[model samples]
Every structure is written in C-alpha cells, then in structure tokens.
Target: MSGFLEGARCSECMDWGEKRNTIASIAAGILFFTGWWIIIDAAVIYPNMEEFNHSYHACGVIATIAFLMINAVSNGQVRGDSYSEGCLGQTGARIWLFIGFMLAFGSLIASMWILFGGYVAKEKPIVYPGIAVFFQNAFIFFGGLVFKFGRTEDLWQ
Candidate 1:
C-alpha cells in the first residue's frame, strides 16, 4: 500500500511538472496579449490627442522591448552554465538582463507618472487613458516576469 501510494504521488508530481511549462507559457502569452489589447481598445476609442496622446504609447513600446530583452537570455546563459564565449560571457548576459529589468521598471514608473501627472492630477481628469497606460505597462512587466522565471529550464532538454 505504501509503495502504491508513493508511486501514485510521484506520477501526479511528474504530470504537473510536465505541464508546468505549457501553463506558464500560456499565462505569459495571455497577459501580454491582454495588455496590448487594452491599449489598442483605448487608442481606438479615444483616437484624438485631446483624449489620448500618442506620446503615451511610447511607454508600452519600451515595455515591449524590455520584455523581449528580458526573455532573450536563457537561465543557463545568465547562470554561466551554458554560455561562455561572448566578450563578457555570463557577466554580459547578467548585465543585459539587468538592463532589461531596468528598462521594464523604468517604463512601469513612467506609466504611473503619466497616469497621475497627466490625468489624475488634472482639474478635469479623463482617467481611461491614464489607467490604460498604467495597466498596459503593469501587465507587460508581469508577463515578462512570468515568462522569464516561471518555467523550468530543464524542460527544454
């Protein structure tokens, strides 16, 4: 009975482990898509400078770039296990990852600044644009994080 129960438990764990990568990928993709979708909706609904400034889209663009940067380096490259030929090797990967994180954070902060400074602080605040900007950055940032750290690197092998 003990062995049977242990075997069942191990199988269950293995099943979940096998599915983890798919689950994480789906979640990250959903978050990224939803973020872009929200921004698109906001832009279409308020296509005028008076309602939504085109400048605000820059934050989402930066965040998208950051997302790509963050995911470009694999865990092994960052950890010095599978990469060691570049000018800086693992150190370079680490630095690139750091810069990516900085960009992500910077974009997110900029979005919040836009939200409060451009909309919330105004006398007659129009909030949808600001909220949309903030959520877009937030979702993209989180999605990048999920894609970067939520999966098992071993699964790729």
Candidate 2:
C-alpha cells in the first residue's frame, strides 16, 4: 500500500508540473488578447477623435514593446549560465531586463495618468476610453510577468 501511494503521488506531481506550464502560457495569452480586445472595442465604440484621442494608443504600443523586451532574454541568459559570448553578456541581459521593466512600469503609470487627467478630471468625465487604456496596460504588464516568471525554465530545456 505504501509503495502504491508513493508511486501515485509522484505521478501526480509530474502531471501537475506539466500542467502548470500550459496553464501559465494560456493565462498569459488570454490576458494579452483581452487587453488588446478591450482597447479595440473602445476604439470602435468611440471612433471620433474627440471621443477617443488616438494618441492614447501609444501607451499600449510602448507596453507591447516592453513585453517583447522582457521575454526576449531567457532565465539562463540573465543568470549567466547559458549565455556568455556577447560583448556585454549577462550584464547586458540584466540591463535589458531592467529597461524592459522600467518601460512596463512607465507605461502602466502613464495609463493611470491618462485615466485620471484626461477623463476623470474632465468636466464631463467620459470614462470608457480612459478605463480601457488603463486596463490594457495593466493586463499587458501582468501578462508579461506571468509569461516571464510563471513557468519553469528547466522544463523547456
């Protein structure tokens, strides 16, 4: 009975590990897709420039760029284990990661600023566009985090 239980528990652990990777990937993808979808919906609903300023899209664009930058460097490369040939090497990876994070944070903050300053503070307070912008940046930032740190790097190797 003891041996059987042990075997079953081990198998369960393995299954869970495999499932975790899939779950993380799916969650990240959903978040990213939903973020974009919301922004697109907002744009469609408020096509006029007066209703929804097109310039606000720049925040989402910057956030997307940050997401790409954050995921471009693998865990091994950042840790100096699997990458060392480049001129800057691990340090470069670290710097790049730092810059990515900074951009992500900056984008999120800017979205909040737009929400408050552009919409909430206005006399009429038309809020759908501002809310959409804020949520888009928030979802993208969180999705990037999930994609970066939620999965086990060892499993991929």
Cα-lDDT of candidate 2: 0.93
Number of the top-ranking candidate, with TM-score as the measure: 1
Which stretches of candidate 2 lie above 4 Å from their native place?
A: 1-3, 83-87
Per-residue lDDT of candidate 1, residues 81-111 (tens digit): 8835566788899999999999999999999
Worst window of 10 by summed lDDT in candidate 1: 79-88
Candidate 1 wrong stretches, greater than 4 Å = 1-4, 83-88
Clashes of each: 0, 0
Which 10-residue window of candidate 2 scores lowest in summed lDDT? 79-88
TM-score of each: 0.93, 0.92
Q: What is the lDDT of residue 155 in candidate 1?
A: 88
Residue 39, model 2: lDDT of 100
lDDT for each residue of candidate 2 in 13-132, tens digit (9 for 90 to 100):
999898898999999999988999999999999998887899999999999999999998988888888835456788899999999999999999999999998988884446899999
True lDDT of residue 79, candidate 1: 79
Candidate 2: clashing residue pairs, number:
0
